[model samples]
Target: MRADPTRASSADASETDPSGDDRAHDAAVPIARSLEAILMVADEPQSLVSLATAVGAPTAAVRQAIESLVADFDGADGGTRRGFELREVGGGWRFYVREEFDPVVRDFVLTQNPTKLSQAALETLAVIAYKQPITRSSIAQIRAVNVDSVVRTLLGRGLVTESSTDSETGAITYETTELLLTHLGINSLDELPLISPLLSDGRGGFDDVA
Candidate 1:
């Protein structure tokens, strides 16, 4: 037998709300956590459009949620220390360690035994630091040897970084890192201790320091 029209009307009436505000609220916590994880794993800064699509939300809403997360991390709720933080740089959002804890983190990471550097690597770094924005071929010309391995090792260690690529020749250029400044205990490149006096011997030849 078919159900009665009257019964169907009763069921509809029971389900209806006059105010029409009974839609269940969606929790933002899970979405926020996913956003955090994405930023944390990214090797570099992430963009708003990319993150919004990743979290399945509108860009504006994602931006607000990211700001909220930043506030939460900066707050002192007294739990486990946060492993990473959300930061804005170069007009993009990035995850980085909190500045206050960087020293501790560096100390922990640097405790490992030293790795050896070849004479070529040492010379290549010196040339780049003193005459930066230099190309790999220039370095090779100066050292009179192939600088490929030296350049590769420097890039891997973060002691050197690419400055730009020459448009005409498509040559990649390298420069010293800020880490080099800190390592050398100097305020800036201009403060690098002078070796010019030693190089300026009367006939442009100096005694070897052996």
Candidate 2:
């Protein structure tokens, strides 16, 4: 018996069509893994468009991935809810420690790791303590080097915090925390050494050093 030509043509079409098995397989691969990996190290929340561009996925696909992650973290898939959650904030997405676990995380961070600050961190902290509500650029100018990592370390240690952002320049201004005072055993910044006595220029303490 001869094979039917129409059936043979149908089989050929199925094999040749770009929308056949290959596309289905690609669709089955979840984009959540890509999104998760990017979110893990992101210091700030990323917008959907930004996330899509980073992962080289379509915006709709990224959105769907975010939804899937949210569901999984919420235990909607019959699994234990995660201690942390992906959250959308300020028009972007980031992971946050779930409110119920905040105390545990905070305590662990405070008690478990009491490592000493580096010399760079001490100098950055001193600058922030004296010149507070100062921009990172100004701090860098005073230090005559990049202070990014040291400033981040101070922030991580809870010794410095963002006081405010400049309205015109959009620069973040940092200030020392009460925790710094507690560590220094001082009541106020006035307890710090006088700048004039330390400077050869007598008018510019930090600038002279810089």
Candidate 3:
């Protein structure tokens, strides 16, 4: 009996497309939940292209998802408004604490987390350590959260110091102190892992840099 070409092609297609069924399943959940997860830990605003690349979605879909998220966070759909929000700055999207909640959040960080470094302080310190001589505003831009209180904490702890102030902008730049190196148990910033590799994009096009 001769082999049937039609049946042979069908079997080959199935073998090559074994996971075609899973594509829909994987894509179904990534737009909202995955974006939220990414934004939660993000250190800076992410552009639409970057976000789409991370979530494996088209830019259009990502835009729609962003709009939906904005509305959701704003309580437009009759849900409890979130204390934080997704905001666009420097041509990217990032999360920020609502203005009204800043005082309370700062108080909690200073009072409740007195013994240990709050996450905000740690993040700000890392920024200064890697991007030394960075302004407070620059640090805030990278973190997409206000760094004023966190900078004060690092200053009080002696982990970071004001290195210089911009002559043109008058923005004070910060640098890591010896105390921070001692705590880190490293000789220099070079010992710190490459910042690009740790970032989500691996290259973190940080030209705007706050």
Candidate 4:
């Protein structure tokens, strides 16, 4: 009477594969849905690696998912083309208001009462507008208050958006959007009033106002 070595080996292998069941469960998630969930809240374009990591999918699968999303949004799948488009910019993927729909979206955002921003959002937007590439921590420091929610509000309103991420600090730097300028009836940041004169002491400028 002898024990089966093959059965014992199979048991050992199964014991070592801690993630085998988890991986199978994760595979049940549709790649497109996973990508959509992550991209919806993503403030900036996500690289393939980042998207893959966030979705727990392989890079090739993520790339395919992005392509599928592009086609789906473009009406290639027999659906109406979306008002927004998924674009690859600066080596990453993000959603943008389609060029033809920008005016409509802008009008809706600026004129729609439901979209009105709060005082905190306005203040955070102003800081981003003047600073032109300030991080959340820096904005919080200038305002002397937590700006996380306010910044999210500005982003939701399309007044401010992430411009870049700090390589060393991994902080997201934000800036005013063209939609903000359109709402303000201005062509450029230069058209905004100078903060230096607005300060009573004119010593610390924006920091003093905040």
Residue 115 Cα positional deviation in candidate 2, in Å, after optimal superposition: 2.7
| Every candidate's lDDT | 0.70, 0.79, 0.77, 0.78
| Candidate 4 structure quality by residue, lDDT tens digits, 1-210 | 798999999899888765865664455348877888788877656888999998787898788778878888899957999888898875788887798986677567656647567788887787788876888888888788998878867765777877887776655689988888899999998889877777676644275432
TM-score attained by model 4: 0.60
Query: What digit string (tens of lDDT, one per residue) describes model 1 on residues 1-210?
Result: 999999999888877744333321124456677888898666445678889998898887787778767877877465455766788754567777787876776565455425766777887887787667888887787678888777867765667887866666545678998888887788788886554554546222112221
Candidate ranking under TM-score, highest first, comes to 2, 4, 1, 3
In model 2, which runs have C-alpha deviations exceeding 4 angstroms?
1-29, 127-152, 161-176, 187-210
Q: What is the lDDT of residue 133 in candidate 1?
A: 85
What TM-scores do the predictions have? 0.48, 0.61, 0.48, 0.60
Clash number for each model: 0, 0, 0, 0
The residue-by-residue lDDT of candidate 3 on 129-158, one tens digit each, is: 877888888788888888877887786666
**Ten-residue stretch with the least lDDT total in model 4:** 201-210
Q: What's the C-alpha lDDT at position 90 in model 4?
A: 59
lDDT measured at residue 151 in model 2 versus the true structure, 0 to 100: 82
Which regions of candidate 1 fall more than 4 Å away from where they truly are? Answer: 1-26, 76-83, 117-210
Weakest 10 consecutive residues of candidate 1 by summed lDDT: 201-210
Better of 2 and 3 by TM-score: 2
